[model samples]
Each structure stands twice: as structure tokens, then as C-alpha cells.
Target: MRIRIGGEVHHGDAVDLRGVDADATAVRETLDLAADDPLATVSATPPALSVALAAAARERGHDHPNDAEIERLRAALATTEPPDSSDPAVDLATARRRAAEAGSDVARLRERVATLRGRLRERRGGDAEPGTSAGEAESLAEVESAFEAATRALTEAETERVAARQALSRATERARRARDASERERSRRDALANRRREARAALARELWDEFWTAFDAVAADAPATDHVGDDPTAFDGDPVAGHAAAVRLARRDDPVVVSAPLFDDEAAATVRDRLRAPVVLVSAP
Candidate 1:
């Protein structure tokens, strides 16, 4: 049987204790002795070894239900309930499309404004050329009238382009707000789902019930060891120091296990103190 202690997996006799009847009294005595002198009391007996391994596994927070099982539970939970709100996905997509259309409109209007301005400039430049005689005064008057009309058109086009830009800005802001709201909703949903998964896993594992029973049985007659501090460093709170200490104890065949990422070679050497048992590191697939 394979046993996962913390994130580390131990196979063969290292963890296997199937059908081995555990004597609560003997296990407790061994634990008490191991607490004081780990090397002397932590022998290769099935019951004692199992208790040690279980305790270690608990310490490292590796006593959860299997990942595949938790994932299955989560999937079932998701299917059983309707989502809290209508999916923001479609809303977000619509907002983005509207923003894009508005931007395109702005671009088109700006192009029109540029064309009108260019025409006005060309007309004015032609009028500036000194090629008009008094006989063509009426022609010059007609040219001036056309130039004024071009100027008016240019002004109207510029005003429309400015309006288009403002509309685009509003649309862009709406899209941004929509995107932010969608993200926040997703994050909230994910956090809720994660909590549900953890609750389900805890129920399935029943580690708390088992650990409490074991603890009660052991504490009934055994004296508590002072090796662990009143507030022992928690794996989640101080991972580096906790993992280091756990690994050190586990190597000495103490009732402790650790699940953590592998440290660098130098750090590992410093922590392991040249021990031969390789530190096992497990990661999610």
C-alpha cells in the first residue's frame, strides 16, 4: 500500500501496515519514549511505525482526501447548483463588441474630419496664388464662397469627430468596468468553490475523528513530551523553518513528516545535516 505523508509518498514497508493490529497501549508507550529519544524507541514495528507515520503525516498537512476524489466532489457540487448569477461572460463580450464598434466609428469620423480639413487647406492655398485679374473678380467671389462652405463643412466634421471620440471613451470605460466586475465575480466564485472542496475533503478524510481518538488513547496513560513547543511552528505559517525541522525529525525516525518543495542543494545539505534518507517532495500534477 502507498502512504502519502505530507506531500511525500512512501512505499513498501516504509509505510505499509495493512492488517497489522495496533496495540494502543504499546503505541502510546513507544510514542512517549520516541518523544524523548527518537532513535532509541522508533523501531520497525508495524503498529508503532504506523502511529509515527500517521502523526508525521498530520503534522505536514498531508492527511487530506485524495485529489481525484476532491475534484470529483467539486464537479458534482458544481452540477447540483445553479450559478449564483447569470454568467457575466456574455455581458462582457457584448460590452467589448460595443467598445470596438465605437472605436471604429471614432476612427471613421476622424478620417472624414482630416479629409475636410485637407480640402479647406487646398482651396485656401489656391486662393493665395496671385493669378486673379479684375475681369475674374466674379470668379474670385465664387471661389471665396466655396472656401467658406468648405470651412463650415470642416468645422462640422471636426465637431462630429470630437463627439465620436467622447462616445468611444464612454464605451471604453463601460467595457473596463464590465471586465473588472466579471473578474471580481469569478474570483469570489472560485474562492467559494475552494472552501466547499476543502469541507468535502475534510468530511471524507475524517482525519480529525481518527486523530482525536488516537490522541485520547495515547494521552490516557502517557506523559506528554516537551519536545514540541507550546506553539509549534505551523507548516502554513512558517514553511521554511517548519519543513526544515520536520525533515530533521523524520530523518531521525521521529513521529513527524513534512510536505514541501525541494530546497536548493546548499540549503538541503544544511538542513539534512548529511543524512542519507532523501527528502521526498511531491507536487500537484
Candidate 2:
């Protein structure tokens, strides 16, 4: 590939930028470059090798499947917790118990009122005035008062039972709604996770297919080592030879820039012959 940087036109399949000032940044200003891969790099290794490799994988765009969606779902799941109805369920059970007890109290009160009225009836025997005498009138008044009090108590208890049942119904409905929302949230996350997994697998398969294709095309130019024969895996593991093979696998038209002091002159020349793509080696000042 040919590149023009700062009024200087440079051309070659594998041009060595041997100078005190030609840097990687200068090369990028001239040519569009992909993010650097450290696995092929054997130069001054970065302090955080693992992190750099992880970053390189991300740059290659295969390891993470639907990274944006994965992150979004993760954020949402973390912030929006699932609702639990254990407390509400317990409250409903307790309310039902209280209402049952209140009903029993109302039933017992009715029985007491019936017994008092029967006593008053027996005392008013013969078609005479019910409470003509002072004693009888006093007794009748007491029965009337007791009857009114019992009716009032029964009304209050029945009201309480109705309220409790309504409250429990409302609480159960709310719990059902909460459960549905939680299930939906889980479903969304699960779907995204599956898609991401499938996408990553598809990307890997595509790359594998492309690599073998490129290997077949450039195999003639690539010199075979004793251990690295026809086996593609062996060739892929060679530091100097694999680097050239990688360049061959890259786009045939675009120029990739690598730092100098990483390849020897003789090897670089031989490697250059094997590559289908162009390469520029820049030197750091």
C-alpha cells in the first residue's frame, strides 16, 4: 500500500520506517489502522498483558455477543430488583384468621341476645303489660340495653370482616402483577444472553473458515518449519512466520502498521514476500 504522511509519499509492500521520529501515531495519521493485536506482538510487552489481550479481543469484535444489550440488561437487572410477596401473603393469612375470629364472636353475641329475649318473654306471661311493675320494667330495660349493645357489636365485627377480605383481595392482586413483571424481566435478560452466545459462536465459525481459506492461499509462499508442517495450527503458533501469515489473512488492499525493533531485517524481508497485504514498520523516537 502507498501512504502520504506530512508531504512524504511512502510506498512498499512492507516498508520499514527507519528514522528517529517515525511513530505509530504518525503512521495512523497517514493510514487507517485497526486496533493493535498484542498476541502477535513480541516487543516491549505492556505491564497489563491480560487486560491488553482482552481489549484486543474486543477490538476484533467476536468475544462479546451483543455487548451493548448485555450491558444494558445487566444494568437494569442490578437496579430493578424482583418484588417478593412473602410479607403480603403472610398479612393476608393473618387477616383471614382475625376475620374468622370476629365472625365467631358475632355468632356468640347473637346467641346471647336470643337467650335474653326468651327470658324477657317468660317474665311477661299472661297478656299483662310487659314491664308494669318497677322491678319488671327495670329488668326489661336492662334486656333492651343488652340487645342494642349486642347488635352494635355484631355490626362492627361484620364490617371488620368485610374490610379484611377486601384488603386481602387487593394485596393478592398486587402480588400477581408483581410476579408477572418479574417474569418478563427475566425473560428479556435470558433472550439477550442466548442471542449473544449464538452470535459469538457464529463469528468464531466465520473466522475459522476465513483463516483456513487464507492459509491455503498463502501456504506456497510460507516456508515450512520442521515442527510446523502441513498442520495449520503449528503455522499459526510461529511468532515471526505467524505474524506474516496474519498479514496475509488481513485485507489485501489496506496497509497495517507495526512498531519497528520487533522484526529482524532478514526475517521481515522474507515475511514480506509471504504476505498478501502491505505493512509499515514505524520506529519510536
Please estimate how well model 2 matches the true structure, expressed as its whole-model Cα lDDT: 0.56
Model 2 C-alpha lDDT per residue in residues 127-154, reported as the tens digit of each score: 2855378777677778778877877887
- Screening candidate 1 with a backbone cut-off below 3 angstroms (N, C-alpha, C), the clashing residue pairs are 56-257
Best by TM-score: 2
Query: How many pairs of residues collide in model 1?
Result: 1
> Distance from true position, residue 280, model 1, in Å?
50
Sequence-dependent TM-score of model 1:
0.30
> How accurate locally is residue 147 in candidate 1, as Cα lDDT from 0 to 100?
58
Sliding window of 10 residues with minimal summed lDDT for model 1: 276-285
Taking all chains together, each candidate's TM-score versus the true structure is 0.30, 0.44
